[model samples]
Target: MSTAKDPGKGAEKAHGKPSAKTPAKPAEGLPAKILSKILPPAEAPKEPGEEEGEVPHRETAPAEHGPGPDLRRLTEIARALNSEPELRHLLDLILDRIVDITGAERAFLILRNPEGKLEVRASRSLDREEVKKPTAKVSRSILVQAEKSGRPVLTTNATQDPRFAGSDSVAYMKLRAVVCIPMIMRGRSVGLLYLDHRFEEGAFQGVDLGLLEAFGAQAAIALENARLLQENRVRQAELERSKEKVEELNRVLREKVRRQSAELDQVKQVLRERHGEMKLKYAYPEMIGRSRRHLDLLRLLDRVIDTQVTVLIHGESGSGKELVARAIHYQGARKDAPFVSENCSAIPETLLESELFGYMRGAFTGADRDRKGLFEQASGGTLFLDEIGDMPPEMQSKLLRVLESGKVRPVGGKDLISVNVRVLAASHQDLRKLVEAGRFREDLFYRLAVITVEVPPLRDRREDVPLLVERFLDAFAAESGGPRREVAEEAMALLSDYDWPGNVRELRNEVFRACALSEKVILTEILSPQIRERAVPRSLPARLDDRPLKDLVRDSVEFVERRAIQEALARTQWVKTETARILGISRPTLDAKIQQYGLEKQG
Candidate 1:
């Protein structure tokens, strides 16, 4: 239904109803008849004193072809453009204008398709069948003039023009004059708005073209916005996939650690039962020592196979507490299962629970879906909790429950699912003292203390210094694909002498430093200066010639190595983490060495 005033008013005025008269000049090439119908009728002079020469305002500028109407009309158009955001609503308004002004009896707004053909996007007095009939493509001839000239085009007869083929279905409705206005953007017309006159009284006037050109401009803007929005949506979807990959990486790291831990436990027990000289064949026992302190740790590992009780491994920060944990899990019954690990102190308390137990969909506003907690992901595997002392107090209760009941309850979920898993806990804190001071839970402490294994510091097992250094050098060479770098006998001795506060972790870093900066075969000033400058337990040798150079270097290296190992062990609780840190190796490496050296069986 038309919303504007009836066009019957035009007929009444033409039939000599006392309407106002107009005397406006039409633009070049515009028919004077167009100016007559579109311009407002001039009114009689109000009084003799009034300015008589002033031309009456032509709200619909039939002559100028400028923007039609005045501020109020433009404002209304702008409001409509703003209020109706959807493209469908905007299309409806445009087609209605074409039918009302250009006298199109039945009209449609066709859009270009992916194949570059026209398809009717919306219509007036038309259904999908009429649109999809395949003839809906506007005649190429009709589009040529306006597209080439960048102006309005008029066709007097539809049957004559080759664009609208005369067919039985199309012939039923009369199509006379077509007034096509180019839809222009960036000075180029992208599409067309067309109208037809089905009756003699409905011929298009110049004012109709002016109105259509403005509407066409508006329609183009709406369409461009819709296309850009779709592109952005596609890009956002791609970014989400990349985020999922990072989550996958984190999951894989935990799974690897769990599997290795369970395997170590198995290896530990097998050695005890067979006991043929109790010679251990840990992954990397070749480059090293023949010390009873070093070998005892391996013996203890053999005794503790099949035990899922808490194992609190203590050592200095650089000590291989984490390494021992790995060895225990990897060599144990859970070898086939996941060896998941959590760095208790890394994540904040606020996020720790959600990260550990997972969350339900809508657990919090931005959570779009439910997630599997880490505990569930590591079910039937060993969970290595590192930095256990640093865990938030609030989460401690939950940890205790899981250990006691072997079940995990994710946040925002009701079901308490049982997990067949072993817990391997490690920390640098003195849990006994912490418990006495009411800082740590005594009950939780007892549960984890079931099979406590103290790792001996590196200083106590000076016999392993030569072994650790040799292993580190080879490992670095293999991984870097670079020729192996070695330490001078003197540099080795100096390294072993310092009281290493940073422990085995410090040793690994120093070795990496030597590898990173070592230009010559032997790491000299670039490496030795660091170890040489630090305070040695014994005074510095006065001259290299005083003792056998090899012995002198070995003593220096062992002294520093022992001191560093001792510091790390104290920090970690006599854990092989000290050796792991000294060698700049992984916890699993240290664990394997701990068993090989038999440190676990040492007094």
Candidate 2:
């Protein structure tokens, strides 16, 4: 935010008439001393086709005669970004670091102003007076040219060049020799942060150009943080205003006139607590079991509360990996921090890295700027990586590295950032099998398996079904925000006895369907038909009916498999893992059954 004025002066006109003369210098000039102090010291700009050598700041040399000290300063820069406020100040720090990192003659962050003109938001080269002067409204200029090119636009002799002498921006800024690189993100150039040579002349080498690009990434992140912080502050102010109004209404209604009455204070505290919960909404859907199985789960949850040891909950799809993950996160020690959950199988392999680790400005072809990835967002709390077995092999390698180093390097990033967080990974698949097949990494498996808690399927935990049914009835009733409903005892018995192939997940959808379809208070036979034929041991059914045992066993397995697949398909709405979980089966097993039965949705 230098306040330097334009340096170029127009020649005196004869008879005070307008002529083809240079622009006139304003009367009051901002001093270089003021500009230099405010503007960050920058690296000199490199010429086109420059070498890839890093630039070091002169001021930094005294403090960092060694590499260790220089790196420490960069770490300090990262910590600084987390707390820094003013956009101008941050931009100044960033631009200065870029200059220091690249050894540029001068550096500046030229942001696209609202009018679509590039304005010097922060400049290190100009005096306060030169920066203070208003810039001409030049339509897309060489600045745009440099952006489109995606490489440094080098000029050995600026004044001699046809474009330089006539350009008002160049003339005003007094560009002698310049090298500019566009700051790019997600397929578009946002602005420019580059250096040019005003002290010495010659095109910048390739090495110098590469170094500047590295700085460009750091700059984008710092800029993004500043913008987000400002937005968050505005939102916070709005919330505070709303809260005050609510408090005023409460004060009037209660007619309480005390500094802090006990009842009022309790209500106020509850209100304060609710504000935090409002930020995070459950992305994971509800599970369907109110049966004896869930009673065991609740007991386990109660048992695990005191210790911070990692617990791995293994379960089939409808078995509720996410519900368990949520319970662990919300009731766990790091509940105050983010509970960032990522379904590893949901996104494509190619995009997963960028989604998980984030990317830098111009790291790839379309990267417009730096983006914060999930791992960074989930720091200081639990990161739930669902279906971890489904992650790609290459990504598994990256994941292992992060686990080992406790650090992440964003895609196209220059520095490795350390993070403190807990990792809670869940997969219904057998990791040992994946390793045997060379599909999943063994190293990653052990690293993630330090504590594993397997969630049993609905069929295994049949004793819990009655409880689950009751639980779902209430939960569904609350969700409807309508009159509560009940399940007929006969229908409830059928649900508990039926082998739940789709596990807890399938049970939920069934309840939802029954609730929506049934108008009466008690859900009847029509709503429970899909679950009527319960899977049981053939011998058990035979014993009841005095029938053949072998045939019953064969019939039972087929019926169970079919029900599980159907329920899974229903819960996941055709997603692979959901179907697998519903059946208390592995993804591969479910896929095989789907293919065998041709159960896939028709095109």
Candidate 3:
């Protein structure tokens, strides 16, 4: 008995790749050893009626085996191959079928890599360790037959074949009886399917070659389908990632756009506010006095106007604390927002909390709708709390919380609403005194008095009196369409001497009344009785001799009128127009009074 040559020991590179000359060598490395252990050698068929010791007569066997068994085996292998989707798993299934169906001693698969070189991808029937080593080159003659014809090539005796008889690979390994089948897809060879028998001279017949060639065709199509599907899945995954990135970018862009839009709205609001401030500056120009005290107050305003610091104004009740608060708010950064004012003393204590902190629609009786409090309404702006010292102690504590947290809990509401309001408080009562008295919260006093502005009373800034008088005169005259009135020297002197207890607000009312009622000039009698009566000395006789009251009143009126004419004429240097203006009487009236009183011009 003769042993067949082992083709696995043929020439190979260290890394299991065959050189250009030979292909279809045995598997190498650990994989080869593993395959050898798992894959048993092929058993040859026994000849009919042959004794056990007799050699089989291969030359007498038919060129082709009948198709019945081959067809059945091919069907089973086809089903297995068709069910597989993965390329590696499919290749393994194909290699197994080739060995089992062909009854070959060893088999392996080689495919073209990305670099267009044939690489051993799978193997069977070799030592597992050998399978791990480098691939060995086969006789050059076999590659030529498979590649040239794009068909399966069979060798009944590879060692004696003229094309590879002297080849070192075949001679050394004693290889024989090999078959090489080309795996074709789209009419082109992608790889080779190889199987060989070492002992049997004609181990592979026509029927075996036919079955393998058909299997290779189907395997090629299946492998290509699996590869295309896998490629599509990868491309789809990449597209999904790209889509997610685009969505993220869109979200960022939308947020940026929204923020920019909000900023633009703020800019527009600021421009409108600036326009309003320009109007206010012109409308209230008289409020800006030339007096030193007023200038000092304005300077302090300039320092704190553009900031968000709280301001507590200390002044007499009618000394224009609200005016100062308005000036500061209209000049500040939050000028574009609302300016809301609430007089703590004006609102009832029961209602002050709801008015300052708002209320839910159903929170209490008469709450017909939800309402925003002064703080919320004044968000991003100023909230002027006038007479803040009069606020209830409980409210002061709540106000302190609002200042610290910038949040307000509405009356009868559960949630706290955020607000960005600048508080400007005013009080006639000294907050320090109130704090010491425990009438006001100490923390609240400090919170509201980050800056203190003292508005001088009208008495303190008498220089502003003339200016205020002129403004009020013009305003009243314009409103009533009456002739403008001038103050007589005596009446002006009377006004200048009196300390105004009601401050500027009282002065304005008096001026409006005098302007409306006076003929052409404000005289002593046209002034408030307080001013007129104060002008007269109390020691003067109430009535001389108690003579008929009417006659005495008439004589006194005449005496006063005559004296007023003489004084006016002397001051004007006896100019009729000058005298008429000084006396607050028309030129004709002055002339009539001058003639009736027998008055003469002084030198």
Task: Score every model by TM-score.
Answer: 0.43, 0.41, 0.43
Q: What lDDT is reached at residue 103 by model 2? A: 58
lDDT (Cα, tens digit) per residue for candidate 2, span 418-520 = 8877788888887888899999988888887766776767765554565566677778889888766676654654665676778776877787778787775
Number of clashes recorded per candidate: 67, 73, 27
* C-alpha lDDT values of all predictions: 0.61, 0.60, 0.69
Taking the tens digit of each residue's C-alpha lDDT, what string does model 3 give over 422-534? Answer: 99999999999998888889888888899999997765554456667777878888988877778776676566445677788898899998887887888888898887765
Residue-pair clashes, model 3: 27
lDDT of 3: 0.69
Tens digits of lDDT, candidate 1, 1-603: 111123454323332343243333323222222233333334222333435554332223133232224223434554565455566666777676456545565565667778876556766643212333424535445665566776666555565556456443334444555566676766655567755555653255434443455556655665566556656766777777777787787789788877888778557644553354455545323324444444566666666655767788776676677777777777787878888888888989888888878888888888889898778777877778888888777788888998889888878888888888777788888888888887788888888878877765665455465467667877888889998887765466556554556766677777777877885445447664656787355633323534577556654664444444444554566656565776687887555544443333212
Cα error, residue 581 of model 1, in Å, equals: 38
Better of 1 and 3 by lDDT: 3
TM-score of 3: 0.43
Off by over 4 Å in 3: 1-288, 535-603
